[model samples]
Each structure stands twice: as structure tokens, then as C-alpha cells.
Target: MSATSTVRRFRTLAVPLAVLTVVFLVISLPPYLGLDPAKARLPVPEDVPWFYPALVAHIGFGSIALLTAALQVWPWLRRTHPAVHRWSGRIYLGLGVIPGGVAVLAVAPFGQTGGPTGQVANTMLALLWLATAVAGYRAARARRFGEHREWMVRNVALTFSIVANRPWSMLCIAVFAPEVMGTGPVDPAVLAQAAGVSMWLSWVVNLLVAEYWLHRTRTRRGVRGGPTAKHRQPVPATS
Candidate 1:
């Protein structure tokens, strides 16, 4: 492989690996090492009986979506078996629509922040995730291949928010949590709220970055000639 190709391959592999590693460490290590959920548990929204189910659905399907996304992006796997990639795409869409949609509904009333900001952020995240996936599928069906690719790229980036959220949360905690940063003592509740805000920020930032990258890549390749080239018609000869 050329140097550029090698670098591209490394990047493709490295991003997923880094994302997965961070997510795994955050979910698994933190709970196991020192972070006690009982201590961490803030008051649940009393009015939302469905909160637990929604939380389960959010984390469950979210994790599946993340793993499948990683697999879909694996260079060797995708290059070797296009069928697997396609099948995984279908599954990812299904997961996003059902579990992700339900999770959104659940979040609106029961988000961690438990206020207007949390509700808005979680609702927006859920809607964006669902919209991007539906848009991607529609584009594929309409044979607007470029749009499909762009939409799917955005959808996957949103899904990867599960991976991105923790790192951003940690950064928020470091900045705002005096206990962690060894400044003066700070309110744990305030730090928790800040972390919740960070989660939404991470996903929004990722979506924006993904869209920018997609536009750049598409523009660089010249809209007339990338993977979507076959979708266009030949110019007719002049008389």
C-alpha cells in the first residue's frame, strides 16, 4: 500500500479502537474501580415510570449500535465482505429507530439533568439520531448515493456519541470538579449536572465535525465523480 493508503487505513482502524477503548473503560472500569452507582444515583424523576426501561434501552441498543458501527468501519472486514457491511447497516438503522426512539421519549421526562436543558438536549439528540438514519435509508432507496453516504456518515457519528460522551464528561468533570482537579471542594451535584451537559455537547460536536468532514471529502472528490458517479447520466452529444 502507498503511504497515504497506509495512513488512511491506520486512521480508520485507530478511531474505532480509540472510541471503543474509551467507552469500555468508562462503562466498565469506573463502575468497577471506584465509582459507586448507589452513591452516584441522583433522584429519579418520580413521574416517569418508564425511565428505567428507557435507560436500559438507551444503553443496550446504544452499545450495540456502537459496536456494529465499529465493525462496519473496519477496513479489512468491509473490504472483504460487502454483504456484512450492508447487513450491519440495516441492523444499525433498526436499532436506532426502535430503541433509540424509545430512549428519546424516555429521556424527555427523565433525563439526568431533570430540567429544561436536559430534556431539550436529550430530545434533540434522539431526534437527530432518528432523522439521520431515516434520511440515509431514504437516500439509498432513492438512489441518491452521495446523499445516502453523507447521511449515513452523520448517523454513525451520532451513534458514536456513546463512545464520545464519556471522554467529554471526564473533561467537564476535570474542569468543574474540585475533588478531581484538587482545587477547593465543589458540589458533586453541580459536577454531575455539568457532566450531563457535556454528554450532549460531545454528540453535537461530533455531528458537526462529521458533517464537515463529509462535505470536505465529497467536495474534494468533485461531486460528479465519486461513488455516486454511476447514479448520474451521460451528457448527450451536441447536434
Candidate 2:
């Protein structure tokens, strides 16, 4: 319908999503911050001495990415506080995505339960995460605001994938390998299979949903720009 209605609908979704994103980050990041490999949710492979360190780096920087992504995509922040948007975007790309992506690549090969499928999934996610962040940054630098928004949206989707992964992993385990979820000792092979399934499901579903949302926004607005600029504020020079 109208631009105002469209924006209102987006605001309704964006606000809760941002809140939940912060909630997820709070629940996930603190344990890793202690730098204890034993505290990691995934089973850290002892043979790979660097895996735990890399996993810590990934989680640490990824937490920053996820946190800043909430601010970066919030309509009110971009419209009313463009400087915050730009600075957060910079932090998301520079301090978060780049380092986080590298750390994920380092740990992908040593995934505890996902096996080769998990490794491939993680590697692909890291590559796509870095690529989208870079593309978004370049688009902003080129003053291609519309393209930049779309790219950043993709980056945000990737950032949120890990938050979605927990539920997906649990679901996969419950359905495909219920024994893995038992109180008794788990079969490593079954756990690995379930984890591999979850790894594929989580990011793929997130990306698909993101693409669908982008397409719907474009269709409704009939613009290559994913969202309307009617409420956009002038970005600060320092941004």
C-alpha cells in the first residue's frame, strides 16, 4: 500500500527483531568472553590447539557484529540518528565482520559434531559474511545508497544466522537423532550427523528468508532500493 503503511509494518518487525537479537547476544557471548574452551557450547577439539582460540575470537567479534547489526538496521536509528548508523556500520564491518569471518575460517575445519558438512557450511557462511560486509562498505563509499542498503541487509541476515542456529540444531537432533539429546552418553556419529543437518538448515533458511523479504520489499515499493528513503536523514560527514 502506501509508503507510511509499509514503513510502519517494517518498524513493527524491526523493533522486536532488534530486541531479540540483543537478547540472544547476551545469552551467547558471556561464556565465551571468559576464554575458557570448556565453556564453549560446541565441543572444542583438543588436537587442534588453535581451534579454541580462534573460536573465542570468532564469538567475540561476532558478538560485536550482531550487536551493531541491530543498530545498523533499525529504521529509527538510521532516520533519526544517521551518525550512529554510519559509525555502527563501520564497526560492524571493520571490527566485527572481518576479524570474525577470519576466525570462523580458522575454526571451521575443527567443528566438533558437524563433520565435513558442518565445516563446509561454516566456511561458506564466513566467506559470504565477509563478502556482503565488504560489498556494503564499498557501496556506501561509492554513494550508491540503494545498493548499500541491500548489501547491508544481506550482511545483517548472515550475522543473525548463528542466533538462529541453536534452535535449528536442537530441532535437527530431536528429529533425526533423538538419542543424541538423551541424558546418557551420546553417540558421536549420530551427533555429528544431526549437527551437519542443522548447520545446513540454519544459514540456508536464514538467507532464503532474507532474500524473500528483500524481494517482497522491492515488489511492494517497485524500487531496487529495498526500503524507502522517504524518512532517511542526511548522513553525518564523520560517518
Candidate 3:
């Protein structure tokens, strides 16, 4: 392809994701920036003293992870700007995912509505998030680029899982307690149940979708002997 066409293709794919990432951060970060527990977007449990700070930290770092991971997955950046990709990968893994995952562990057990189901689902999500990221990092270190990409796909799926949680929660709430859709006050128990179910639905669905996409890509590339062009163009860690 011509240089101009390559750049055009890059812009086409990267711009929309970049804008969405910015919008997501803009909507997510403002409430937590004030550092007041009372202003948290999620319901803060009165009994868990550390929940607010931990939740805030997770959101803060998760935003960085989201932005950097989005960039890391861009084909144009990986192909032409390998150095930027590696640096961003480091930031995405170390400064963002690690801390964010740790904070998630700290707060997941304290679900938004004090529900056991959410606690379990969120805990599992955090664990898998960290595991996939670490596995991706290890694969990159070993120069197993295909494995790295696969693991990172799973990692990114978990990273973006929060995006799905809101809608799922709303849908669950609407189904479980339609009264919530109206002006009436929400029932705490029903809210908790819906939140818990949504938490499970969000990460589980994202993960399944990621796996399905990976499987389809692999199947399509079976004749070509690899998953993607990325396997053929391994970005060096230093570059």
C-alpha cells in the first residue's frame, strides 16, 4: 500500500476509538477527582472504610489502562511506531493495569450495592484481568508475539468490561424492578441483586466475545498459518 493510504487507514481505525476513550474518561473521571466519597458514581458502602479510596484508585488507573490499551491495540501504531507501542504497553501494564487490578481486588468484595454476587463476579474479573495482562507480558518477553496478542486481547476485553456494566445493570434493574425506571425510590435489595447480575453479565459477555473473535480470526487465518499480520511483524520490546 502507498504511504498515504496506510496513514489514511490508520486514521480511520484509530480516530473513533480515541474519541470514545476520551469521552469515556471525561464522563468517568470528574466525579472521582474531587476525592469526596459522597460524590462517587457508584454507591459507597457505609461500613467499608477503605472502599471509597480503593474504588477511586481503580477508576483512576483503569482510565489510564483503557487509553493506553486502546493505543497499544491499534494496528497502525504497532506496525509503524513500535517504539511508541512498547512504551505505551509498559505504561498500560505497569502503571495502569497492575495498580488498577490491585485496587479492584481491594474493592470488588465490597460491591456497589453490597451484594455477594457482584463481589464474586468482580473478584473473578480482577483476577482474570491481572492474569491475562501478566501472561501477555510474559509472552512478549519471550518473543511469542501471537500468544502475547491473544492474551492482550483477553486483557483488553476485561479492561473495557466496565463499559458494558452500566447498561447491563440498567437492563437488569429494569427487568427485576421496573419501578426503578420510573420516579419511584429504588429498593435496596432489588438494586443489589440487579447490580450483582449485571456485574456477572458484563465481564462474562465481554470475555466470551473476545474469545469468539479470537477463534474466528484464528480460523480465518488457518490457511495462512497464523492469527494475524501481527504474528509476522513482532514489535521489539526496545523498539
Q: Count the backbone clashes (under 3 Å) in each candidate.
A: 0, 0, 0
TM-scores, all models, native as reference: 0.75, 0.84, 0.88
In candidate 1, list every pair of residues with a backbone clash. Answer: none
Two-way TM-score contest, 1 vs 2, winner: 2
Regions of model 3 farther than 4 Å from truth: 1-8, 11-14, 183-186, 225-239
Q: Model 1 reaches what TM-score against the true structure?
A: 0.75
Q: Put down candidate 3 lDDT per residue, 12-76, tens digits, no spaces.
A: 43477667778878887898888988788788889989999899889989988988877877887
Please give the RMSD of candidate 1 to the true structure. 5.1
What does candidate 1's lDDT look like per residue over 43-161, in tens digits?
Answer: 54657676655665666676667667766557666677878977887887777455776686676656665245556777887888888888888887876766776787787788777
What ordering of candidates by TM-score runs from best to worst?
A: 3, 2, 1
Q: What does the lDDT come to for candidate 2?
A: 0.83
Top-lDDT structure, candidate number: 3
Q: Candidate 2: how many backbone clashes?
A: 0
Q: What do the candidate models score in CA lDDT, each in turn?
A: 0.68, 0.83, 0.86
Lowest summed-lDDT stretch of 10 residues in model 2?
Answer: 224-233
- Cα deviation in Å at residue 102, candidate 1? 2.3
Q: Please state every model's RMSD to the true fold in angstroms.
A: 5.1, 5.6, 3.9
